[model samples]
Target: MNFGERLRFLRNELDYSLRKMADELDISFSALGKYERNEHQPDFETLKKIADYFDVSIDWLLGRTQEGYDHAIRIIDNAVEKMDPNSEVELYIPPAILNEMILKNIDESHLSLIPVYGAANGMLNLSESNIIQYEFKHNQDMPEESFFYIISPDDSMKGSNIVKDSKVLCRSLDIVDKKNLEEGKIYLVSYQNSLYIRRVFVNNQDQITLQAENVHFPPILIHNMSDINIIGQVQSVEFNPNEQK
Candidate 1:
């Protein structure tokens, strides 16, 4: 199920009558039905209200994860609350593609194509059991291990001019590269169980700090590097808010 399907599923499973829900949300019944039908996406405020009403994370509502309340509550209830969007941009990567690349560590002949993902979940490992589709967009010479893309989830990185729906380019890092992280550079990181796209700073004492380009989001400090995984350094981005895909 995609976002709309999941929304409907939740309403049915939880016995949230459409009329009741619509009234509670202060929206028309037809609008609520449209949301369930995937005909319209709720604005941020309405989206937040829906999440709060359903007690689910935005990621789960968007079908980013199969995890239930126990696991997803972390993203919403923890510190930096409402800060990270768990930007899971669903892609059409079929299982066959994962097997081809992961099992064989496919050679450079296949390097021209890399997967771009949403900044939703942690990127400790790339193979997601539920991901579908096998679409590939040619990217010349991008053979770096763990090279990937993320559709910008929000305007937190707007200070860097990276806005929502921006296609961000990035590549994972090795231990050496992680240790020698350049100060004042942006990185895609996994903190707790969620993914974050932020500017990174490493202190002489090995502490790490995650800063958002948009000042609205205060910089996050990590006393223990173990708490977060440095997914990769963001290389470039392309933006088009009206993007169909």
Candidate 2:
């Protein structure tokens, strides 16, 4: 794609608007509009800022090369292959974890699969105690089994879709990559010797701010250095009939 087309495409793919990009680049929206519309071009310094913002190279911006200067095109290509928007991906769930989830709730028939959409999003343990177990099996090593649970100590995520005492299920692999986090979606995260269930608000640089589904809970700042653990990406929610009328 040409410079304008590439800029527009990357901006749209990342869900950034002209105003936001302009603000970040310290330029006027009209200037950004000109660049996007091919009406004008940015100087070297401005071009550098744009390239840095998009993590691309100036050469890539000018269409001198098919790949960006960062040489991260391979990574992006791999990600695109794995994360095909048109395809439905299935997670490889182990049988042991499945049984544990059923027994943890004390209602085998009530157990259902929840689809989590974010990195830290997962099934939340709402039992009186943490009965959920993590079973790990590896080559030439005994499987490690441990039990843990998360709770939203604050009422930040009170109303909306995820409420207090909402039992959520999480996938084990969602936390590792930390790339598929969807903003405005609820997630179960482990931070500072505690487990919290909250919605994720991403600002930039893969750093996320945690917001409660309920306004009562104050928002938490999650830095990259924080020892946070994402147990699963929440896929779906299971509502128990007994809890309802």
Candidate 3:
């Protein structure tokens, strides 16, 4: 069966009515029917919501693969929002899309869409997963990797330019190694399963103390050396509270 057919089958197997699924998905009931009948296709954003709701990968929804959903929590949870006023944004992706992209690296040149949350909309505190695709002309010094955006959750390290709602470019690094945790540099440290963007204050001691930029947040003291894992270091940050207004 095609992706659309499979989507319909799953919806039915779960004993969800068309309107119920539509309401949950923030889509019109007729639209859900259309997707089932293969009359139309969901955009990337909508597809992501559907995938998240079903706990399936986009690849699976697209009929790219025939594997049962395996729910594995990743490091960071990417979120998305729906445009509809009546529904909330859900996280869902098909396994097929992920698998295919893994096998054959996604061609970034074909897609250049960026997901921008309407920060102005107070009624809508929404997050959307936007995969932006772009191609640049040949240049002498091309960056090894483009900056991926991540929003900060704390104000500690404001002294070092980190604040809440700060969009940052984090250079991926191996933070687990003691040698990798350089002194005086800001790093996104994952201590005891929770992720924190802070400066490594005292890596010299057997216990590491992570200091926050803002005075309000308390310093994180990690006792077990084995529990600390560094995900990446903050290269730069951009703060714009005005957008939320």
- What C-alpha lDDT do the candidate models reach, one value each? 0.64, 0.54, 0.58
| lDDT of candidate 2 at residue 152, scale 0 to 100 | 28
Candidate 3, superposed: residue stretches over 4 Å from native: 1-147, 242-245
Which candidate would rank higher by TM-score, 1 or 3? 1
Q: Candidate 2 versus the native: TM-score?
A: 0.36
Order by lDDT, highest first: 1, 3, 2
Worst 10 residues of 3 by lDDT: 71-80
Write candidate 3's Cα lDDT for 133-178 as tens digits.
1112122232425323456555566676655566665666765556
Candidate 1 residue pairs that clash:
86-120, 87-120, 92-132, 92-133, 93-133, 94-133
Per-model TM-score on C-alpha atoms: 0.46, 0.36, 0.41
Off by over 4 Å in 2: 1-129, 132-156, 174-177, 240-243
Error of 2 at 113 (Å): 11
